[model samples]
Target: MMVRLGSSASRYVIATMAALALAACGGGGSSTPTPTPTPTPTPTSSTPVFTSPTTWSVDSGSSGVFYIATATGPAGKTLSFTITGGDDQSFFTVTSSGGLSFKSPPDFGNPQDANKDNVYVVQLTVTDGTTPVNQTVYVTVIKPDADVRVRRVGTGFNQPVYVYPVTDGSGRVYVVERTGRIKILDPKASNPAATTTLLDVSAEISTDGERGLLGFTLSPNFATDRTFYVFLTNASGAIEIRKYKTLASNNDQADTSTADVIMQIPHPRNAHYGGWIGFGADNYLYITTGDGGSPSDSDGNAQNKSSLLGKVLRIDPATDSFPNDANKDYAIPTGNPYATSGGAPEVIAYGFRNPKRASFEFATGLLIGDQGENSWEEADLLLPSDYGTAGTAPNFGWPILEGTHSFVGGDTTGLIPPILEYAHGTGGQQGSAIIGGYVYRGAVTSLQLNYYFGDAATGNVWSVPTQSIARGSTIKAENFRLRNGGFTPDVGTINNVVSFGQDNAANLYIVDADGDIFIVEKKPTA
Candidate 1:
């Protein structure tokens, strides 16, 4: 290795020796070859996410696990669910397996949510021991058919006969008592049973038979004029539709001193004084009167075209057609069937035995619940054609035909039959007295546009589809029972229903003659 040669040969020998030394030392030409860098491991899983629908619907009384939240997370990691934050988050709880449940059963009518709407909202969180993923979810509580029930909102009424809404946005209702007293009720009050007397006509009204303060309604212009009307049997046993004004000092109190008699009709008997009075869509006062009492309309008042008894009368209370007479202060509406010369100017439709209650379906339709004789009870729906001059006036075939079945005697020409007729009995759908109700235009979706009526004698409630109230059609009705919600202390079937009412919001009410005011609501339980 020390032998020397020429310069080029010496250089080659030196390089070779260096290369061999390097090889022996296990070294490369490049200064220590950089070690292959270990790559950062790729994520084994993605961020946790909700794999369930954000919106869900459950039956009103649903509790426990109605919905399940599914999520995907890291391998070998447990995905957990939780209600993080939201207006109604306190109403719900979640499990490690992602099962979402209600802490308490929900009621569609009385929502516990922050908004108090049936739609419930919550903030849902999902995590896998990492950064939490969040989502806003909504759950709706649905009202089932079995969930419709009546809950007592007011009590201690002295035989409440009718309930009228103030419609002044005050949420107050005027309850008319059979003893000639009107009281104001705040259903949401701390003590709903406590009431303030609005008016007392006990001294002026006769409470004989089906008399006394029978019906009450607010003037269409009540907000401004503060005028209201009452239907009562005066001490002399005459039907009187009187007008009164609310005290300017207090919206809840009426002027108890005096009332103006809008119209007064002499009746032969006390029992069949049709008492319901209301303003129609035409801004005219519509008065319902029964046939001069005796069984089978023995006096033939229902068939007589000139008699106002046994008829629905349309009159303009704002005008004075009978200026010379104080008993008939109102003017006949122009479109009244006999406004010109055909019949009694006030009579719009005749041949009703005793239309105890009637309400306008809208502006153009009138529904009358006429109590029957011994065979049948009936409800008649009168359209514009039946009351207006453009069409034949409705002749409900009272004495001549007792609800599509021939009974006594009358001219059979152009008779309008009852749209709904039921047998007279206290069993099943059969009922004795028919109490007319409004076409439900309330917040309850299932009851919308359905016509409701009740039986005072049988204590049964029934409803028929509005569309089924057509001529020449045989329609059936359904038993519409607003029962007690077994989950809580609730009022069961209202007995001796005197009337049905509607508030400004169109929420329907059932008036029990035994001193209770019930509101239609969702069954209060899960």
Candidate 2:
């Protein structure tokens, strides 16, 4: 919501009609008794008339300080105004009547880089001691439309964190570009020419900043087993997931090669490796991992169900190796609530401090997004009958608790809370980190499909509807009457809203770390 600039004075009426036609051409052409022809006095252009209260709103609650007023020329004369763009203009307090109040600006830490749909042009000059008038404001800042739309398509991509898009049902999209390349766009090419580079892995991933080649999946029978899966971090930091087999003829992917590695996890800390992979609805293969980074959870590994880090794993991969005997490449779906207690049998939800993105609701398979820490940021729905047909055990409390409170005490009893929770401090408007998404079921959007997804480290985008959620017998969960809709995000710039895929035509895709790839449609309605 911080992409500001819309106080709307008829959209800045060309600097207020050229400052009222230069104040009616400097008024004065007298002739009293006889001394008449004394004209030629034209030099009075004093423009600086920005009246007060065009629009302003404030409500920070947990704190104080909010004064507004910023005057400059016109009414009386001697104009003066100077309160440029923002970044905390000393917290703001301009009153000579031009009013400009402020006191709540830092909590956006990185909220998707405060997206104004990628627009930045700020100017506010109004002086009249010697004439100077300029006005150009156009700040949009959006993020809450969710038919996803990270679109940048492709480029050289060096710090390209993660993209993961896969579509092959015809219009050809397949993105995946976390420096370990793979970019093919082909909207039926002839000259579609948007982005291309099937797969590279920069000689085996590891591009840093939370490590690269983050996650991808495409093998629910990719038309005819073109097979795919990736979740990298390799080059020594560890976390691998590997598996590929494309060959290229028309699927457009060209060469893939390696066919199996399935799992790794070492990660001595390059950054929270909550990689994020999907294939839920029982086809088995759901991963999320992160308590391995720094900050609070230090080494308790987010509740240590025998260290899979923060945990959410459920792999089966259909075999290539690494199954039984504890852990190697994958297997462990025997319902996994810690399968047999010795621990790492592929966990299946345990505490979690960085469950980046987990979605599945292609018509009520439930299992929604997760991301909570610091002050709060969560969203969950689960319920495939509570994961019994296979994919069981779900605790999700983390470091004793966070969205319901109790940061480090123990026994949150049955755990599992959060149907929605936001607030990261700084007078609390919300958002620090939590970018989980998807619950649109797109065909073009009528909207209420029980929406429940999130995003914000400043990337904005929010929705929380599954009827507003209630579920309470102590397992914790409550979110009522909520309605924060702003920033309409569906234009561009989306780094790390990571996983939201769906193809075979239910249509929905929003993967981004930098290797952009949007496509969430539904704004038509003429």
| Candidate 1 lDDT (Cα, 0 to 1) | 0.76
- CA displacement after TM-score superposition, residue 327 of candidate 1 (Å): 1.6
What candidate 1 gets wrong by more than 4 Å, as runs, is 1-147, 390-392, 477-489, 522-526
Each prediction's RMSD to truth: 31.1, 24.6
- Model 1, 14-60: lDDT tens digits are 11122134334444678777787799998755788677768776666
**For candidate 2, what's the RMSD?**
24.6
- Backbone collision count in every prediction? 1, 29
What is the lDDT for 265 in model 1?
89
Q: CA shift at 34, candidate 1, in angstroms?
A: 99
Best by TM-score: 1
lDDT of 1 at 294: 88
